[model samples]
Target: MLRMAAILILALGAPAAAEPLARELFGAMAKPSAQAPEAIGTYARGCAAGLEELPESGPTWQAMRLSRNRNWGHPEMIRFLKDLSLTARQLGWAGLYVGDIAQPRGGPMTGGHASHQIGLDADIWMLPPSRVNLSRAEREKISSISVRTEDQTSINGNWTRSHHALLKAAASDPRVDRIFVAAAVKVEMCRTAKRADKAWLQKIRPLYGHNTHFHVRLKCPQGSPSCQTQKPTVAQLSNGGDGCDETLQWWVTDYLEELRNPPKRKKPDGPPPKSAKTYVMSDLPRQCAAVLSSR
Candidate 1:
C-alpha cells in the first residue's frame, strides 16, 4: 500500500515534460534564417546561419538528390565546389556530381548523416560525370560506383588516373581541412605518388563507406567567429609525416583481421550514447536556439 501511494504521489507531483528532438526542430525549417552567415558549433552538434544553396544545375556540376534538400552550404563552400568542378572540367571529365552539402538551415538532419550539421562538409560522388544536366528523376535513380574492390583490399579498374589527380588537387587546396576516402584508395595513391609530391597525402584520411563518394571538410571561413575547429589538426594527427606507412597498412591488415576474427568483449551497463538523431536543443550551443528561432 505504501509503495503504491509513493508511486502515485511521484506521478501526480509534476507533469511529463518531454522535449522534442533537435533534428525534428531543425529539419522542419524550410529555409535559412535571416542573419549574417555563421557556423555556430562543432560539425556534429551545431547549426548554421545564412547558408547559400548550390544551384541544382551548373555549367560544371550538378547537385544530386534533389529530394533531400541538402545542397545548401556556406558561401565559401559554394565557391570551393564551383572551383573544384571547374578543375574537374580541366581534367577531361564533364564535371562533378556533387552530393550532400548540408540542409537549408544547417543543423542535425532528419536522417542520413551525423556530421554535416555545419555548412563546411560536402560529399563528391566518385563516378566521373559524363554530363551535368541530369534530371531530378535521373539523379534519384542513379547511384555512384565503388572505386574499391569487393574485398576492400585495393582499388578496382574504375579508379583511374583522373581520380588521383582530382583528389590530389582537392587535398592541396588551402580551404580544405581534410578529405575522407576508402582506405584502399589512400593506399593506391600512396603507392603511386612521387615522394616530393606526397605532402598533401596527410589530409587524405581513410574512412569506411566512402568508396562511393569522398567527403570533403573545409576549414572555418573568415567571419564565422563562433565556428569551432576540429581538434588534433591534420598536421598534429599525422605527426608532420604523410601517414602513408603504418596508418594505411593497418586498415587492410589488422582491421581486416579483426573483422574476420571478432573479439569478445563485455557490454557496458548504461543507456546508449546520444547521437545527432537523439540530441535535444539543450545539447547544442545556446546560440543554436537563437539561430533556430531567428526570423
Candidate 2:
C-alpha cells in the first residue's frame, strides 16, 4: 500500500507531455528555421518564452484574441506600434487602431493586405484639424478615436486640407514605411505634398493607395526572426496632370484582385532583391511653389 501510494503521487506530480509546434506557427510569425524546435518539449518552452516577452497592453496586445480563423499577427507587432506612436506624435498625428474599428461602410480592412490579425499594423485616420473647422470638442472626439461601421461615411467627409497636411506630416516621419489614402486624395496629396517636401513624398508614394481610410505600416521589430523585409525606393511623384488615369484604374483593379486571392507561399527563384525606396512626402520637388500656394 505504501509503495502504491508513492507511485501515484509521483505520477500526479509529473508534467504532462508537451504538444508539437505546427509549421504554420513558424510561417505565420516569420520565425527562422534555426530557432524552431524539433521536439514538442522544446517547442512549448520556446513558445512560453516568446509569449512572456510580448506586451500586455498597447495595440498589439489589445488586438489579440483567439479565433477559429488564422490572422492574428506576431507578438513583435506590439513593439512596432509603440515605436510608431512615439514617432507619429512627434509629427503631430494621433494614435493608430489595432483593428478596423473605424473602417468606413465598405472601406477596406484596417491593415489592407497585411493581416490585421496579429495587430502589428494599424489605421491612422487622417483627421487633419485644419480642414474640418470643428470646435475643440469635435476635434477631441476625432483624435485617436474609433467609430462604428454606420458612422464611417460621415467621418470620411471630414478629410480636408488640414487632414492632408497631417497625412503629409505622418508620411514624412522617418519611422513610417507606407500609407494608404483615398485615390482622389492621393492625387491631390501627390501634387502638393511632393512639392511641399520631396523626401516625404517619395517615402509615401509606393506605399500609397486608394483606400478610403489610411493604413500605416511600420518596420518589423527585432527578435522576430520571421519578419518580411521591404527594400526602400526613390520617391516617384504622380505627374500632376492626371495623365495615368487608365493606369491608376488598372492598378486598383489588380490590387483588389491580389487582396482577394493572395498567392500561395513559394521559394523565390533568386535571392530576394532589396526593396526600392518609397516616395514619402519629403521627396517632392522644392521648386513647385505653385502647388503649395494653391493648397
Candidate 3:
C-alpha cells in the first residue's frame, strides 16, 4: 500500500490544486473500443484509439489487478500477449500472469507508469502461472515474489530455469521491442548462458523495480504511422554488444539506490507542482489529440 500511495502521489495527486487536462479527460473514459484500436504518439506520452481488452482469463494466461481497468491495449499488444503465452506453454512453462497494459484510452494514468500510455507495453509477472483456473479474487489476493536480493544485484534463491525460459521466449519473439528485468538477472544470464544464445540478452535490458515482474515493450506495428518511435531503440541496443555491459552494474548500484531513495524536493514555490513533463496533451504527438477526442 505504501508503494501504491507513492505512485498516486507522483502520477495522480502531486498537483493538488487542479487535475491535468490529459489526466481528467483520459480518466473519464471508462469503456473500451469507443473508436478504432489505433496507437498514436510515443509510449510514454501518447493515446490509443479503439482499445481492446485481454480476456479476464485465458486458457494459458490470466489478467490481474482487474479493478484498475488497465487490461486494455492496442490490437497488436493483445495479440502479442496471446501469442507469447502460447509460446511459453510450448516452451514447457506455465502461462503468463499479466499485469497493466494500458487504460481504456491510453494517456497519462491515475497511477503507475507513463509508458503504458500508448498500449504497446505490457507487464508479465515473473511468477509462472500454476494452473489455468485462477479466479478474479485469486488474482487479486495472490502476490508475485521479489527476485531481487537486499542489494538489488541478484535474484533470490527461488529463481529458476523456468523464469529464465519464460523471459527468453518473450525476448525471442520478433514483435517484442525489449523486455525490462532486474539488472542482476542480466548479469546472471551473461555468466550462465551460451555464447551463441547471448545475443538475446540485448533485449533483456535491466531496470530497477521489476524484480517481481518483467515489462515488455513492443515496437510500433506496420501501418501505424502515428505511433512514434522511442530513442535508442531495441535495434540500437543490440548493435554494439549484448545489453549486459557495464550498465548492469550501474543499474544495480547507483540506479537502484536512487530509485529507492529519490531526492526530496520542497513544495512548489510557485504552484502546488504540476504533472510530469510528458503528461499533457500537447506533449504528445499531434495525432494523439485526435485520438483523445476521436469517439
Candidate 4:
C-alpha cells in the first residue's frame, strides 16, 4: 500500500511529456489556412522583436492596444518600427508616431479603418510648419485641437506637403506592401516617386489610395501563418464571355489612350482586400492520407 501510494504521488507530481510532432502538425493545420510556413517564421521573428521593443504592460502600449475582438499583429508593428527608423534617418525627420507621443494622448490621425488595429499602422508627423511650401501652404495647416478628438474636418485639412514627402519615402521602401494616402497626396507622391525611382513607383502605385491620414501596410513576411498567396483576378471566360482576343485589344487601346493624357487624380473604387483567401495545403494533398494513417 505504501509503495503504490508513493508511485501515485510521483506520477501526479511529474510533468506530462511533450506531445509528439504529429500532434503539432494537427494543431498547425487546425489554424487558418492562410498561415504559411514562411509567413509563420517571419511572424515569430517579428513578434520577438516587437516584444523586446514594446513593453507588455505600459501606458504607451495600453494607448496603442487594439480592441480585444480584433487580431492585433505584433510582428507587423516590429517591422514597421524597424523600417521607420531607417526612413526617418534618411529623410531627416525626428521619428514616427501615431500622435504626438510627447503629449501623452497625442498620436496620429485615426478615423475609418486604419490598419492600426493590427499594430502595423502608424501616423507619421508632417514636417515643421516653417518648411511647408508657400504655394501649398494652405493645404498643410492641420488644426491640432480638432485632430485630438477624431474630427474629420481636422483630418482632411491637416495633411501637408512634408507629410506627402514622408509617405512617399515610406511607400518607396522595398518592404512596404501598400500605402493609403489622401487622394491629392497619393497623386503627388506617386508622380514624384515614379520619377525618382521607377521600380519603387511601380510597386507602390497599385497599393496607393487617398484617405485622411496615411495608412502604411508592410508585405507579409516570409513565415506568417496568416499570409495568403494571391494572383491578379481575371474574369473567367464562359460560353459567351468576353473573349480573350477582344479583352486583349481593349487593354491595348486603353493603355494607349492613358499614355496620351494622365490625370491629376484617380480614386480607387473601394478599399483594397486586406489578405488573400486562397490557400494550397501541402499536407492536405491526396497522397497525405496514407502517410498520415500509417504514422
Local accuracy by lDDT, each model: 0.88, 0.35, 0.77, 0.33
Candidate order (TM-score): 1, 3, 2, 4
TM-score versus the correct structure, for each prediction: 0.93, 0.40, 0.84, 0.39
Best by lDDT: 1
Index of the highest-TM-score prediction: 1
lDDT tens digits, residue span 1-295, model 3: 3323433443453563332457656766776646766788788778888889999888888899888889999889999999989977876657888999998888878777857988999999877777867877887889988877878867788678877877788788888888988888887877787887877778898876788899999988876778876778765865756776666677767887887899897776764433433355555566655555545
lDDT of 1 at 122: 98
> What does candidate 3 score on TM?
0.84
List clash counts for every candidate, in order. Answer: 0, 38, 3, 21
Q: Compute the lDDT for candidate 2.
A: 0.35
Where does model 2 exceed 4 Å of error?
A: 1-114, 117-119, 126-157, 194-196, 205-210, 231-295
Identify the runs in model 3 with alpha carbons over 4 angstroms from their true place. 1-20, 254-278
Q: Give the per-residue lDDT of model 2 (tens digit) for 96-142.
A: 33333111111112222323322334554443222323343443344
Q: 1 or 2, which is superior by lDDT?
A: 1
Query: lDDT by residue for model 1 over 1-295, one digit each (tens)?
Result: 3323323433465332245677877887778878888887988889899999999999999999999999999999999999999999999999999999988778899999999997999999999999999999999999999999988889999999999999999999999999999999999999999988888999999998899999999998898898987887888888988879787889999987887788998997998788898987667886777677766
- Comparing 1 with 4 on TM-score, the higher-scoring candidate is 1
Candidate 2 TM-score to native: 0.40
lDDT, candidate 1, equals: 0.88
The predicted structure with the larger lDDT, 1 or 4, is 1
Q: Give residue 79's lDDT in candidate 2 (0 to 100).
A: 48
Segments of candidate 1 deviating more than 4 angstroms: 1-17
